[model samples]
Target: MKKEEVPQDESCFSDTEMKEVIYAVDKDGKYDKALSSGWETKTIVLDKSLEHIEERKAQAIANIKNGIQSPIAYFMEEHRMDIPTLASYVGIWQWRVKRHLKAKPFQRLSAKTLQRYAEVFEISVSELKHPKF
Candidate 1:
């Protein structure tokens, strides 16, 4: 091996040392019990490599971010939406509705007050009074 390529005793780490690093422990420290370890040799099988999986994860995150930039993003940010009502009642918060009209091309709302706003927007009054998302 070349001079630079030569592995040093202090620098070189064994599987046990590698495991300690992965678990974020010291030389003689114990790894936390609450951790999962899967191996390629095990029953699980997929053609994709770890890099490919990470790339897909990054892409998915990008897509979610882009979705947030849309008119629908106004609704998500304006109020803490009820996950159950996602399919049933399509609604947005009072303040975000104005911003949506000014910036993003969206529908016109008729309500001026909070109660009227909820009724016009089709969201419950409870959701409007709760807090910003």
Candidate 2:
């Protein structure tokens, strides 16, 4: 496509300095890099993905409040991590991470264990034990 014809559709990046690099044919018929704020379809897809993540986080918070899950569950959702991923990050077994997702088991966790999770979440141990929702 011609450089001047590159899609510059406004999107979520409109308020920021970020731009997507797109290759287009220049006036001399040579490929050149063009900057785009964003395109409509990509914007819609990103918005939907973010919405889904928010929904998941909300459910995790509700589970924590209802005692169906632990504060670890909420932090896991907030960090966009699954049990295996979180376990890998914290240097624990996947099953242990799964166990910790339950309120009872999480309550029995040692401070050092909780500290590992907090480090992975980049928060404090207190925050890990008592998430701020």
Report lDDT per candidate. Answer: 0.38, 0.88
Clashes in model 2: which pairs? none
Model 2, TM vs. native: 0.87
Candidate 2, residues 1-133, lDDT tens digits: the string is 8988877889978899999899999889999889987889898899898899899999988888999898988888888887788989999999889999999999899989988989899999887877886
Off by over 4 Å in 2: 27-29
lDDT of 1: 0.38
Please report how far candidate 1 places residue 73 from its true position, in Å: 16
lDDT tens per residue, model 1, 1-133: 2222222232113234342112334345544332223334321333344445555445434533554322333343333333234324445454554354232233333335345545544676555433233
The runs of at least 3 residues in candidate 1 whose Cα sits more than 4 Å from the true structure, single-residue gaps closed, are 1-14, 17-48, 68-133
**Per-prediction TM-score, please?**
0.20, 0.87
Index of the highest-TM-score prediction: 2
